[model samples]
Target chain A: DTAVSQTPKYLVTQMGNDKSIKCEQNLGHDTMYWYKQDSKKFLKIMFSYNNKELIINETVPNRFSPKSPDKAHLNLHINSLELGDSAVYFCASSLKTDTQYFGPGTRLTVL
Target chain B: AQSVTQPDIHITVSEGASLELRCNYSYGATPYLFWYVQSPGQGLQLLLKYFSGDTLVQGIKGFEAEFKRSQSSFNLRKPSVHWSDAAEYFCAVVMTTDSWGKLQFGAGTQVVVTP
Candidate 1:
């Protein structure tokens, strides 16, 4: 069984379009996070939620927003997507201060 | 500010050869250290972690890492490498002071195994 899972394993959309990625974890974790991996493979944290509460928000553009409906789910929405937004988005979950489990990742491609 | 560094951007090893991946961190106190492996088109898998008590820790797939406080390093090692061992290796750390499990990751090292 999958521990953490993300929808739309691959997405391709034109620039200026809007898209969203959904994440869910079955590990009974209290915290969840979103990380972006660029084409160069450098990964950076975007947002983190603890028990459905926003805890960490990096210096990402306002066009990017994270919504946590519950402790088990965290979704990312992007508005007016740009070509530079093309990258792999990863979802992770963990207990507070504990090891994290990552999803397979959603590859986003903006044309 | 705390940061992690992976000196080698890429490494190539022959099957059955020994392998070593270097990692260093900059932090006032010893932070929680971890090593993760990301295969092609795959998610990250935790190889091992060192919270405390021991400087050397063993991980799955016959991998091991040694934490050296003096050197500010935690280098991963494997005695024999197999073709399946090739993957992107990342060194990450969680600052003990951080309440949330925010991980500071290094620029990963890409390992390529050849026969």
Candidate 2:
């Protein structure tokens, strides 16, 4: 069984289009997180949710939003995506503040 | 501001040769350090971590790291290299705040292995 999984491994959309990436974890972890890896391969934390409660919100733009309906799922929705929003987004889950298990990652490209 | 730094952008080595990947961290508080490896088209896997106790930490695949508090460095080293070990190595530090699983990763270092 996959510990963490993300949908739409590859995403290609036009600029200004709205899209959402879904993430789920089966590791029974209470904390889930979202990270964005840019073209330079610098993986930075975007947001984190503990037990479906927002905890960490980085200096990301307002167009990016994270939704967690439950502890097992954390989704990222981007409104009015721009060309600069192209990057690889990875989802991860962990047992509190510990070593995290990461998903395969979702590659998004805005043209 | 907590951050992780991997100075080596790329490193190549021959099979059976020794390998060392440098990792430096800057954190105000006691830092939880980690080393992760990512194969092509795969998710990141934890190789090892340094929370406390001994400075030298052993990880899977014959990998080990030594955390030097004086230098603020956690460097990953292996006695020998294998072709399968060619991957991107990331150095990360866990945040001390209430937020969970927020890892500040360095710009990864790409390793290539030759026969």
Candidate 3:
């Protein structure tokens, strides 16, 4: 489809386990972003990649790393996930710094 | 630092009634403003955006927002609301020259519409 897509709509894992979420955008955009939405519905930016290069990193823990193999895809890997890591992660993409289109989001739960 | 504030955490409005959601922003310079609506279990959809133009901007679904530079506010309003309008509304802002222009969102307001 012509939209931002994310793998595993819902995720449940142990607190110490490692997990990865993949995101892809077919909008032919040059920039992609990752945002975290807490239980209170407060959305915050975590990272952003432009043309497969890191552009913005919001002081997220080193345990959280983002990899963009190509401009169309950006994947997030979390190491030693903690209870606080549980939240809905959304992937978005924009063209020429225009409107950002968001994916359905991946809900991560650390049990 | 740039920030967005949505004072009303929740609002209940009767169908066919006028609706307004408050949003305030704090930025060092002229910032880009946006209003997004998220339906139940769905990603956010842009209702409107204000970059640079007239102070009053018209958006989709009979929505309109007025940018008050003096007050540093961009408030969303609708003459009449529908039942399907019950959802969460978020106010966001981005720096004009920010790299990637990461959007900073407010805490969001849960809007409920009743018949």
Q: What is the DockQ of candidate 1?
A: 0.85
For candidate 1, what is the DockQ-based docking class?
high
lDDT (CA) per prediction: 0.97, 0.93, 0.93
What level of docking quality does candidate 3 show?
A: medium
TM-score of chain A of each: 0.99, 0.99, 0.98
Pick by TM-score: which candidate is best? 1
**What RMSD value applies to candidate 2?**
1.3
Better structure of 1 and 2 per DockQ: 1
Better of 1 and 2 by TM-score: 1
Worst 10 residues of 1 chain B by lDDT: B95-104
Q: What tens digits encode model 1's per-residue C-alpha lDDT throughout A52-86?
A: 99999999999999999999999999999999999
Q: Write the number of the candidate with greater DockQ, choosing between 1 and 3.
A: 1
The digit string of per-residue lDDT tens for model 2 on B1-115 reads 6678899999999999999999998888768889999998788999999889999999999999999989999999999999999999999988665446578889999999999
Clashes within 3 Å, all models in order: 0, 0, 0
DockQ numbers for every candidate?
A: 0.85, 0.77, 0.77
Across A14-96, the per-residue lDDT of candidate 2 in tens digits comes to 99999999999999999999999888888988999999999999999999999999999999999999999999999999999
**Candidate 2: Cα lDDT at A90:** 95
Model 2 spans with C-alpha error above 4 angstroms: B97-101
